[model samples]
Target chain A: MPYVNIKVTKENGGLTKEEKLTLIKGVTNLLAETLNKNPASTVVVIDEIDMDNYGLGAEQISDRRKAGK
Target chain B: MPYVNIKVTKENGGLTKEEKLTLIKGVTNLLAETLNKNPASTVVVIDEIDMDNYGLGAEQISDRRKAGK
Candidate 1:
């Protein structure tokens, strides 16, 4: 039941909303101190993508097209 | 850049080595399909945790204690 999902590239800003909830509570306290467990069952999910909606295969994309896609 | 990380109880046992790979690919594909992005750019990470090694608060531990924790 350990979950961590991070999808970045929404301009890759430093982060705001309280530093994205303090980076999901500092990555759930670093996975409960690297596997000691029980930081409220550890569940973190962060997804933010922009770069013209994201890409990579048809051409190196993402990174929000350098702010001009 | 979009990434997905799913961590489940290792004892869940609904997947094998190849199935794990398939799960990753499937998740990636789902993300690409849902977001209409390049499959290569979407990274998916799945971490498995054992119940004995993972806990929920101070009790009600993970789904791993049924074996005699």
Candidate 2:
């Protein structure tokens, strides 16, 4: 089983259930179609992270958004 | 920057804040130490998932636990 984890900023009150389901299905399908992994066994977990808790290029995504750069 | 995502069953009421912090720190340190990645730029997101949503070996973890195998 291939465990896939997706991380996204908890913006806009986080993702809706439909978005989460779509993601789960899409990732499962892609892995199954490309990697030959069994879709029934593939697991996908989505994480809604606080912008402050996530950093990229040594700066938090929130800060980047604030700076508008 | 390396982004590490961790997924665990939402058992035992999920992990405590301290546990999540420890996991984030530990994974960040490991990646920095071994991969030469900047700890300041590394991101770690831990997802506590429902057992029913996670599958392994073509079976849900919850089912496995119930079967006591």
Candidate 3:
């Protein structure tokens, strides 16, 4: 089984349950269609991290947002 | 930046903060040393999913656990 994990920043109230379910189903379908993996056995996990906890390009997302870049 | 998301089952008590940090640091170091990616630019997100929400081998982890196989 393949476990897919999606990470998104907890900004703008984060994703609703419907959005998460959509991602889960969409990703499951993609894997099943391309990799031939069984959709019934695939798992999808979504993580909503705080901007301060996620960094990229030597700066945190929170800082990047503050800079408006 | 490379974002690494790890998924684990929340069967017992969830991972301790120390365990999470260890994983984050270890994975970051591995990526930095192997792929030459900047450690500061890497993001590691850990997700602990409920057994009912995670499936493998066409069965939910909760079910598998209950089966004791």
lDDT for model 2: 0.79
- CA lDDT, candidate 2, residue A60: 56
| Model 3 clash number | 0
TM-score of chain B of 2: 0.89
- Estimate, for each residue in B1-69, the C-alpha lDDT of model 3 and write its tens digit: 688777889878777655666677788888888999988778876667899999999999999999994
Per-model TM values vs. the true structure: 0.50, 0.55, 0.55
Residues B1-69, model 1: lDDT tens digits:
467786766664634777567656655554454444467666777677665665655544453376444
- lDDT (Cα, tens digit) per residue for candidate 3, span A1-69: 889987788998999989999999999999999999999999999978866555555455666789996
Better of 2 and 3 by lDDT: 3
Worst 10 residues of 3 chain A by lDDT: A51-60
Query: Which residues of candidate 2, in runs, are more than 4 Å off?
Result: A1-6, A11-47, A50-69
As a whole number from 0 to 100, the lDDT of residue A6 in candidate 3 is 79
Task: Supply candidate 1's per-residue lDDT for A17.
Answer: 80
DockQ, per model, reads 0.30, 0.17, 0.18
The prediction achieving the highest DockQ against the true structure is 1
List the candidate 1 regions with Cα displacement exceeding 4 Å. Answer: A2-4, A11-44, A49-69, B12-14, B60-69
Predicted model with the maximum lDDT: 3
How far is A36's C-alpha from truth in model 3 (Å)?
1.3
